[model samples]
Target: MDLVIKNGTIITATDTYKADIAVEDGKIIMIGKNITQTEGAKLVDASGKYVLPGAIDAHTHLEMPFGGTTSADSYEAGTRAAACGGVTTVFDFVIQRKGQGLIEAVEGRRTICDPQACVDYSFHTAITDLTPEILEEMKESVEYGVPSFKLFMVYKKEGLMVDDGVLAKALEKSKDIGALIAVHAENPDLIDMRIEKFLSEGKTSAWYHYLSRPEFVEAEANKRAIHWAKAFDAPLYIVHLANKEGLEEVTKARNEGYEIYAETCPQYLHFTNEVYKREDGRNFVCSPPIKGKESQEALWKGILNGSIQTVATDHCPFQSYEKDWGKDDFTKIPNGCMGIENLYPYMLSEANKGRISFNKVVEVCSTNVAKIFGCAPQKGTIAAGSDADIVIYDPNKKFVVSKENMHSDVDHTIWEGIELKGYPVMTFSRGKLVYKDGQFLGTPGHGQFIKCKGRK
Candidate 1:
């Protein structure tokens, strides 16, 4: 054994037990009671703490270009923040260029992330131009170890939206290639109409941003995407699912035995559209804007009832000055929030309050993401033969989220001042201690690019 973590309560997706885990060469070599210690193996006493698998944040946009500017966090800063939050692996989007192939986009993204990533990562191609040739490249994409593709159902003006025919064809091709199709489900045409109406009426505040994307806009698109997925018998993954109606559609399809999976972010679980009325409401602007209280409650139910499979952070942030671009016109505000470093702490805090079980948090935050994205058996679990991606969680640790205490490069965070009782005190990525207490100890470029396989 090279390292041993002792006297901790191990929480997995399905079970909770007390055990000591032994690691050797970045992999779990043994897990049991009172494991014999090696002569020179470093020992970590995890008394009075919970040992959980390192979380997998399956959605993020670090250094991503949007709304005429790139996001504030670069790959180094974002993954360092992720490590501080106990996220050992991240799946970032590889946005396709106007004339680039899907695999080419992945390769291009590697140049930016490969040298700076502080934790293991993978890519999901976001197709902007889905021609016949691109559709044929789906198989090669899967073979290239990136088996997921994303399409926007909105953002028509930005040239990111795909038509219904393109979506259907991509879904069919993904199914044939054993790849998963993820969608940003929102009705673009309806949204455009609402935006035009708001601008015409001079109702251009951040509140109107929320109104432009009512729950039905997202619900209709989710239902329509599921309809197409069913027609093609393809697996569909909905990212950042926020509204009740959309979740209902996801539940219905899942109940019908379709492979419909949905992920909800921490922002939707915490804030609502009421934030849009704040003086700094422009900072809260995001697509499919946070819904009302009823929708928020329904999403919690969906989480408990198995409709929502994973919880991630759609963690794209802008500088406060950049967000200020939409002070008078909400259309110019970048649509995202800072939550990668807040995701695990917030969920575990809620779990500490008994809103959810600890095992369930582990399931949604780590296990389900790995299973859905095909990082399982190697990551997501603390068993023998699995990578030692682990977090030492202190249920009694208290902390308030602030930009000063966070690790991202963003000037401000939407999660500021949100106090948390439970937090990850230490994070180990593949047996390497990357973050502990409040310091980052890992080197840049230490993170290898994860070649993700197809989901089972």
Candidate 2:
């Protein structure tokens, strides 16, 4: 044995028990009562703590370009923050340019990420320019280990939106190639109309950003996307679903035996549109802006009722000066916030406060994301034959959220000043300790690229 962890309560998606785990060659070798320690093996005592699987963040945009400025977090900074937050694996979007192929985009992203990532990483191809040749490259992408693709329903002016015909055709191709199609559901025309009206009325404050995208705008596009998915009989995944009406559409389609999956973010669950009325409201501007309080409650209910399957952070942050670009015009502000380092800690804190069960926390934050993104037994479980990706959580450790203690490169955080009752003290990726007691131990160029499998 290379290492042994003793006296910890193990928590899985469906089970919880007391066990000692032994690791060798970066894989879990044995899990039982009182695992013996070898002469040269390292031993860790996890007394009174919860030993759980490492988290998997399936939605993030690190170092991505938007509105003439790149996101503040680099691959190294983001992945290091992920490790500090107990995330062992991340799935970032690889956006296809106007004339680039899917595989070309993947290679380009790898060239930038291969030497900087501190945790395991993978890509999801976001198609902006769909052609006959690009459609063929979708199959090549899946064969090359990326089985999920994304298309935007809004952002028509940015040249990222796909029309109904293109969406339907993409769904058909996904059905043929055993890939999942994910969409950013929002009605562009309605949003454009509302924005024009707001500007004409001289209402360009940060609150106008929330007013421009109402619940129905998101609901209508969600319903339309489900319509196309049903027409093609293919599985559809909704990314960063926020509104109650959109979730209702997801519920209805799911009840009828359609393969529809939805993921919600921490920002939507914890904050409402009221945050936009704050003094620094420009810092809270994100696309498909935060909804009302009722929508927030509805999302919590959906998670308990099994309508929402996963919780990830759409973690794209801009510096304070960058956000000031829209001090007068809400449209000029960047559309992202920092949450990659808060996903697991926030959810675990909620569980500790009795808002939900610890098992449900593990399911939403780790197991479900791994299963849906095709990293299953290798990444999301604590059993023999699985990788030793583990987190030693101190459920009673009270810590305040602040940028001073965070590892990301951003100048500000949306979660600042919030106190968390539970936090991760140590993290292990493939049996190697990377973070412990507010310090980073992982090196750059140590994280491997994961090739995901498709539905077969």
Candidate 3:
């Protein structure tokens, strides 16, 4: 064995127990007590710490273009932030240009991050152009190990939205090809009308951005997308689902046996529309904007129950200056939040306080994301034969989140000033100690692209 983590409690999606984890050749080789550490091999005595699978943030938009500017986090900074937050892998979107094929989209995105990422990652290709050939390309991409496709029902003028016809055809094709279709569910026409109405009335504050994209906008599109998915008897995953109305729709469909997979982000759980009243409130501006206290409570429930399966950071970042674009016109502001570094502490803090179990945190943060995105057993769990991706969490440690402590290149963090009691003290990617005690030791490009396979 090359390394041993002794006397630590391991938490999985369903099990929690103390064991010594043994690793060799970047894979877990044994997990049992009394395994003596061999000479010349590194030994980490994780006494009284919790050793959990590294988080897999299933949603992120690093280096993506929006409006006239691009998201601030590049692959190097973003993945380093991920490792600092105990995330060993991420599934970033491979946004498609109108004329690009699936394979080309993947390769182009790889050119951006392949040499800089500090953690293993994969792509969920966004299907912006729907065509017969693209439909066949979905199958080819699946054969190439990316089995998830993202389609947008909004962003009409930006050339990203697909109509109902394209959505339906994509759903049917996903069914045929064994792929999952993830959608940004929003009633774009209704939102457009609302935006025009709000702008005409001079209601151009950041709050109006939320009003323009009301909860009903998400509910209606979710219902409509599920309608098409049911028509084809297909599986559908809703990305960044934010409220009770959308959760209810997913629950109703799931009650009828539809595979209504969904995820929610920490921003929606931690902040609310009231933040728009702050001077820098515009910084919290994101599509399907965060809602009220009631919505936050409901989303927490969704996490507790089985309705919300994963907790991913939609870690799309724009610096404070980029947000000034929307100062004059709310529509012009690029939407997103910087969240890659706060994912683990936020959830683990909640778990420590009885809001959720520690095991549940591992499930939503790592295991379920892996199973849903087809990276299971390989990355989400700490069993033998799995990649030696792990985190040594110190439940007794405490820290207040601040921009100074953050690793992302962005100038600020939305998670600022929030104090938490639990955090990852050491992050191990494969068998390498990548991050430790507020510093990153891993080199860029140490992370590799994970070829994600389809659900069988």
Report, for every candidate in turn, its global Cα lDDT versus the true structure: 0.92, 0.92, 0.91
Worst 10 residues of 2 by lDDT: 368-377
lDDT of each residue in 1-456, candidate 3, tens digit only? 899999999999999998999999899999998899887779999988999999999999999998888899999999999999999998899998888999999999899899999999999999998778888889999989899999999999999999999998998888877899999999999999999999999988888888899788888998899889988999999999887888888888898998889899999888888998777888999988998888889999988988899999899989999898888678988899988889988999889878899999999999999998888889899999999999999998888999999999999888889999888899999999999999998989999999887866
Please provide TM-scores, in order, for all candidate models, with all chains considered together. 0.99, 0.99, 0.99
Q: How accurate is candidate 2 locally (lDDT)?
A: 0.92
User: How much is the lDDT of residue 296 in candidate 2?
Assistant: 96
Count of clashing residue pairs in every prediction = 0, 0, 0
Q: Tens-digit lDDT track for model 1 on 1-456?
A: 889999999999889999999999999999999998899898999999999999999999999999999999999999999999999999999889888998889998999899999999999999999888988888888888899999999998888999999999898888778899999999998998998999999998999999999898999999999999999999999999999988998999999999999999999999999999999999999887999998999999999999999999989999999999999998989898888888888999999989999888989999998888888878888899999999999999999998899998998889989999888999999999999998999988989898878754
Please give, for residues 206-294, the per-residue lDDT of candidate 2 as tens digits: 99999998888898999999999988889999999999999998999999999999999999999999999998999989877889999
Model 1 quality (TM-score)? 0.99
lDDT for 207 in candidate 2 is: 97
Error of 2 at 142 (Å): 0.7
What candidate 2 gets wrong by more than 4 Å, as runs, is: none
